[model samples]
Target: MLRRLALTAVVSLATLSAVTPAATAATGPVPLPLPLPVLQDDARARLTITVSGSEDSAAEGTFELRCAPAGGSHPVAERACDRLDELAGEDEDPFAPVPEDALCTLQFGGPATARITGTWEGRHIDTVFSRTNGCEISRWNNLIPVLPNVR
Candidate 1:
């Protein structure tokens, strides 16, 4: 009985080892998780800035801005791209709007308005900016060449 038990145990072990490799092979190799920066490398930033209500025809026209290999109709593409990269490195969202509950000075900058639509850091952006009030004006200025310096 002792010999029979040892033989059964040996057979069971062999069977388990043989099935393990087959099961693993059937499932295929496991994929490694990509690093955060590696995943972010695929993200692209492309935007279209359209300004209106400004007397300057230069500032009123639509312009394209592409980063991560900057090339577009924007007057200062390199500077704009650098600014965006700086913002990204600082963990800031360049297209973020002013908070509604925040208090702002009651001052009208001008009628100059801009609409920025496209993708940034692989995220879709469709936001409007205007120099209507202090908050809005500040928001518009923050983007500088990205939105055209209408101030």
Candidate 2:
């Protein structure tokens, strides 16, 4: 009788071991595909802007704008989208550096900095903006609608 009980215990242990992995595998979460872009043509972009300046000024915000619809969290979404459309129309790169020989004032616009990362016209964009110099300041101001709160 003892031998028979031991045999039953061994069979139960074997059954549990065989079923455990299959049950765990079946219960595991299934992988899902990443969501598609909001716009098919890539005319939309989601931007996160962080603003910081001299000892006193600091702000941050985010925007998700689509040119065709002209919408997003930006305070001036329409204007921002228009500005971006203009850049695309002119075949100009907003993130391009200012001319090396261009003259600028010796003024200081503070140490404000901005980082823009998103998709533009089907292209991935990652750029930084700052008021450290004349060119950078121009770049920062040119993108005003998108960085509205940065003064």
Candidate 3:
């Protein structure tokens, strides 16, 4: 009876040992596919904004902005990112310059000037903003938190 019990124990141990390796192998780490460069570009957006000549001293400075995963030194990063995304959906170019033939009011908003440089939706962007005239002021105002509120 003792010998039979020992044999049963030995068989059980062998079965467990054999199953353990298979179980571990089944649950082992899985290899992940490499990320596509274009997908990565589409997933991330980064920008640098510099503001000067504004009446508000707090608004004059350089700021960093990131989107898709929204974060940065920009005061309203999430709002700015959302605004950009909304513009994109509407097929609007945020950095487009006012047309030469377009009539603009001679109104002088301010001496405020801003420069934005960065990447958005996989495209490079380098644009300037100023509150010199009505058209330009409207454009600058459209950008809102992204360019900082001059008034």
Candidate 4:
């Protein structure tokens, strides 16, 4: 009986060793792909700026901005690219949404509008900007470096 009990214990230990690894592996965290930054041949963006309404003078023009060896028609390519990078680093989407409950004055900063369409950090970006209210005005101001001289 002693020898039989010893053999049973050994068999049980072997079975446990064989099953433990498979069970642990089945419940382990899944291997997922890392979020990698996009690579591009060139970092370039075409921008359009337009201002409307009588409160502010009207201005409109189109220009290009480039970075990673910053050189483009944009008056401040380096500054603009730096600002863009800062904003992009904050979140996956650079154009962050305005908070709904945030308090803002009713003051109008004119009907300024901006349109950007190009590649950023190897990703295609097509976004619009408008200053119809306080929040929009703040957003437009934040992007002033890249935008045309609409002010």
Flag regions of model 4 displaced more than 4 Å. Answer: 1-40, 44-59, 96-104, 148-151
Whole-model lDDT values for every prediction: 0.80, 0.66, 0.85, 0.63
**Best by TM-score, which number?**
3
**Position 71, candidate 4: lDDT:** 70
TM-score for each predicted model, relative to the true structure: 0.69, 0.59, 0.72, 0.55
**Prediction 4 TM-score vs. true:** 0.55
1 or 4: which has the higher lDDT? 1
Ten-residue stretch with the least lDDT total in model 2: 33-42
User: Which pairs clash in the backbone of model 1?
Assistant: none
Score candidate 1 by lDDT: 0.80
- Local accuracy of candidate 3 as per-residue lDDT tens digits, 1-151: 6566667766776776667767768897444434422313434569999999999999999999999889889999999999888878877787899999999999999999999999988888999999999999999999998988886
User: After superposition on all CA atoms, what RMSD does each candidate show versus the true structure?
Assistant: 15.0, 14.7, 15.5, 17.1
lDDT of 4 by residue, 1-151 (tens): 6566667766776776677777768897444435433432544443333333324332455667777777777667788878777876776465555668988778776656767777776666677777667877777777767764444
Q: Name the candidate that leads on lDDT.
A: 3
lDDT of 1 at 140: 87
Query: Any runs in candidate 1 off by more than 4 Å, and if so which?
Result: 1-43
Order candidates by lDDT, high to low.
3, 1, 2, 4
Model 3: which residue pairs collide?
A: none
Candidate 2 per-residue lDDT, tens place, 38-130, comes to 323434555555555535333554445556677666667788887887777776688676778888777667766777777777677788777
Is candidate 3 or 4 superior in lDDT? 3
